[model samples]
Target: MLTFFSLVAATLCVSASDSTVELTTFNAGVLAGVPLWRERMPFLLSELPNSTADVLCLQEFWLETDQLAVVNATSDAFPYHVRLETHPSATPPCDATPLQAGLVCVQTRCPSNDSVDQILCALLEENCRSELRAMGQRCLNCLVLGSPNTGLLNDPLSCAVDTGVSYSTTNGLLLLSKIPLSNTVADGYNIATGEIDIYARGYLSAEVENLGTVVCTHLPTPNADRLDAPYFGPVEFNSIEEQQNAYIQQLMNRYSSKSPLFLMGDFNHGPAIGDTVAAEFPQVYQNVLDQGFVSPAETRVGLCTSCLDNSLKSTGSANVFIDHVYVQSQHASNVVDAKRLYEAVLPIGVPLSDHYGISVTYGIPVAEDPIEEWKTAFTAWKDAFREWQKNEEEC
Candidate 1:
């Protein structure tokens, strides 16, 4: 009896120790023109030393120097792991460089398993090659069709050539952890707008031994303009609404099976306003919400304020909430506390990235059934929406 009790206690202790969450903020796209590389990267990383997040997902991360500098700086503190996805626009030609051969590293502290890292790296490289090929194919098709707007084909390909085929890598999602990642899948979603191609984004699912699944994604920003119009209806991409919806639909469809999911990324839209994608696409948000997912920041602080400064402001709008962290409802119940981390107005003279970062701490509850919770939440939300529709029609 004593032996069994001791084992149980030990297991509990280990679980408690592993159940910590930490998130940090780094000014990813800050550096310019090499030389002072080391100095440039660390400055941004230093922002998160206090939080010491278990997983660090940075945006605007330069593929060349910034990624390496981050690995060096954080090596001593978090000896666990690190992974990076550079911007698609920055990638060089396939023949010019090894696929994903840039400085982006997936640093981890698991037992020395060359096969594992090799496989993961190979997967990353293959995905990059596939994406580039797809982009190139699209460009070539556009050129052959003789559309005057060869801008898409010319600009991205040119950028790829100039930046070494690895520049502006879009899916810059990283997974850092002390736990071992048992399995991973990079699911790509095709985002379209009224049959016109907008972009493709990917969702990365990493299974951590006993911790279940963690999904990382970098959703498309509202930058892909289908036309000269400034905004689509009240939102930026109304014509592409169906495409965006399809993408989200695909995401939900693929991951719904993975109950107790934890999703983190730059959603590029917020729940604060009655405008924007989250607002315009409430049904999509509702679908996720129905599927038992909850936005940690939204639940904790209601809505996050604009994280952008004037320099990062491409659009003139003052109200914007672009970044997000959402967890399954069952996962949210385990969550003890959650909040937007970098709310401090930039120090008098210091320049950070245009967007602030968010951090949330979750406490896995003792008795939570993820699957059951998801079904209930989703059904309730769907029913409510149906009733709302009925009221609107009658009115």
Candidate 2:
């Protein structure tokens, strides 16, 4: 990590015409609240300011302490920030009512949402595999959704041993910008059932003074079978690829008028699925591109984002990228530079988070005449000097 002084120097050195602003997106991993977090979080905070990012988007900031920690740490550099409240506004499918037998069907099976809810509750009680099996198809449904509610309950399943501690913490999106922000909007996805129902998965957007509309969000991880996944609600990342796309599209349509849009976050799914994957599986990156967002071309600087998530990492062995920054295609020309902040992780030789941060630079255009502006300034200075001289002579 560069020193704060070095960060300031770098910021000052960038050209005026380009007007480079560093935008960084990182997943704080604060939800886990693991022992490593105690050490890594402070270090992570110290390192960020050193990068001198003009805007920072963070995901998985579940706990109030985690939110406060980031604010306290970066308050000086990023005077403006918004931590989206986790209270979901969308209507939950099961509002204290049991899921009807045939109400929620998946793969031609009538597995009640209540059964799934029961299985989730049982898992919290630390139910064994045999016990979970007894919970039946609903448990199976949980498995299909991923993680079998292991990380959902109080006594997480063995599979979630690593992240069990974090299960209790509530995570959401955070956006911090050096520039003043206005017209803030935050909302959770519409998924009100299964594993995704527990947490608020949504996007946050705000208008920056110089920059266009800036947004930060974290999409649900791709399901085990994208083909069979339900096409309903914003939370479930199953077959409803179009629904997710629509959510973002609506945002762009609503906010693009105020400013060119810049979206940054851990989308959880991307082109990493590979071109060979089934045509039915949703291609999130391609969808974004179709919506007129421009992702940076493959470059050495844009390294794999999911180094820690073995399951999601593109390569089974090596790390691959899932986090991203996208500019509204119409504003792509203003993009001065974009790259990953690969060094933001593990300053003390331990992992701060599974993913490294990424950054982008934008050059907002402004009409100006350098020579004439200088002449005008010189004329004003000369007049002021003469006035001062006359006043001095009178004295």
Candidate 3:
């Protein structure tokens, strides 16, 4: 409540040696067609730009209109934005893939926890429970992951929600920037061609005027493998172990040759950046850090980006730091300031999103010279002018 209104758009100038850029990553938890967006999104968009973050990385912003609404709201401050346009990609023929068993989504209420998610504290009071036993999950997941069974008779795969609305990945990733973005790239993790996830996800990358490359992504959750495994051929235990990390490594290898990089968004797992490795995907976290990346949140112990307090968490959601900001580059420096946006829910206000956002300012060394370079150029010009004058006198 206090944190929500305290959002002030500002950047700190620590020193002249290194340049700084402030960034914020939040999972808006907004579906393209959902109405809750009306209640919460405007507040988020209006307050976010005030943070004056140089870049905003958002996940779960599914649908074209969703991105468009963000653009419309913050275009004055952040004119540059990026997302995977062609994903949840074309759905594979239902006849082509094996039958994946689990429900595309377990239907449940989405209004967020009044106590647990948007405000379901009362719902969890035991006496207030209704469908608590039969169903206990986020309703938003069901709506976003599945739809009416609109496939051919006897075609269970055809009933897949991903095959239906997948011109784009439902992963709903986007990046907006106040700085000019170049060398921009957007890609999906198809493992192989012609495969798609019901909740299609990938990364969006852009060069921030050569200071460094910033990547925004929403990696598939560990459970997501159940849905995606059937689509891709032989895969690792989970998408995070292989396809996702592999993709990150690919980008790191390519970018290291040109510029440093920053990765931000919902990784769907705690980043492995400390002495005690994360139990969830310990290797993946270490592997990424081994490539020379550091997370700001790691230094601050007891921090929870997605805890039971967040209104948008799924039922049975564990308290963890699934969303993270990781930096890899000689140019990138220590965290200047870090704050959690919309951390507390209000009595009357609905939560902004299920995952509380994190705003971090990190230093990225710029290549440009200081005042001395310009002074040297001026002195050289003066000397040349004097020599020309002498030559004219001799002539």
| Residue-wise C-alpha lDDT for candidate 2, range 24-72, written one tens digit per residue | 7887665332335455667767776665678889987665446767788
Q: Rank the candidates by lDDT, best first.
A: 3, 2, 1
Which 10-residue span in candidate 1 carries the lowest summed lDDT? 142-151
Which prediction has the highest lDDT against the true structure?
A: 3
Instruction: For candidate 2, give the lDDT.
Output: 0.56
Q: For candidate 3, lDDT tens digit of each residue in 38-74?
A: 4676676677666578988988776555566677788
The candidate, 1 or 3, that scores higher on TM-score is 3
Off by over 4 Å in 1: 1-19, 23-40, 48-50, 62-64, 80-170, 190-200, 224-240, 273-283, 308-311, 345-351, 365-395
As a whole number from 0 to 100, the lDDT of residue 311 in candidate 2 is: 24
**Pairs with steric clashes in candidate 2:** 62-170, 62-171, 191-234, 191-235, 304-320, 304-321, 305-321
Candidates in order, TM-scores: namely 0.57, 0.63, 0.64
Local distance difference test, each candidate: 0.46, 0.56, 0.57
Q: Taking the tens digit of each residue's C-alpha lDDT, what string does model 1 give over 260-326?
A: 6677776654554543323423454565577677877665655433432434433425455546667
